[model samples]
Target: MNISEQQIWDLTNQAIDKLGANASPDMIRDYVEKEIANRHGGSLPTEKFEGRVIITAFGINKPGIVAKITGSLAEMEIDLQDISQKIMQNFFTLIMIVDITSSPRNLKEVQEELARVGKELTIKIYAQHEDIFQYMFRI
Candidate 1:
């Protein structure tokens, strides 16, 4: 089904509600898939390894976290497709939904690279792909 940015944003917001700042990458990623599919729009084939990466970085929410993560992803040749930035007291949350069209590293590797940045900035990251969604709310 064709997806709109607003709808995606709304879905993203819903995910944020469930997956706070401390949540793992897999958590939010699953929401996007479940919500999209549960719309009764039917299952959307998760194209090859071509998936989306949702990066949740907490602290310095405005540009700092976003810049750092995006910059790091760029270094890894990962492209950003959509993003949501939420800032709270002394903490910034960057929910970046990225396109894995040209990801040079796997999700775990990408997470590893991100860990370095988080270690430096004290920001925690949770990274995951669309497939993780299937198991999120499974029986």
Candidate 2:
């Protein structure tokens, strides 16, 4: 039968206590480590993002629109991972993937600032985390 990691840890600790070997804390830890290493050679790395944001903006095509949004991101030291912008028949559309790992401002502040810029530029802007985007668009 397959046992969970927690179960293995609990059983190890209980056995140690019952045996009363006067084992040192380090020894116990090493034993557990060796046992886990033997059971599982190496654990796989998890997929994680420090911070990710998907932003979409649409409006009547005009100049300096992309500049305004990108300027805010640059000011906050946010990394622009990916971006796409197009203008067709005077309608502007832009989508961006932003990394906020080293940004000085939080997500809320960035959203608010983008909203303010959108109002000034007469465009609509929306931001959502990558995970939320995935969930909403999941099959």
Best by TM-score: 2
Mark the regions of model 1 whose C-alpha exceeds 4 Å error after superposition. 1-49, 60-63, 133-139
Q: Which candidate has the highest lDDT of all?
A: 2
Model 1 scores a TM of 0.55
TM-score of each: 0.55, 0.61
Residue 133 displacement (Å), model 2: 1.9
Show pairs that collide, candidate 2.
none
Candidate 2 per-residue C-alpha lDDT over 56-96 given as tens digits, one digit per residue, 9 for 90 to 100: 99999989998999998899889999999888899999999
Query: Model 1 over residues 93-134: C-alpha lDDT tens digits?
Result: 778888766875667778789999888778788887755765
**lDDT on C-alpha atoms for all candidate structures:** 0.75, 0.83
Q: RMSD per prediction, one decimal? A: 18.8, 10.5
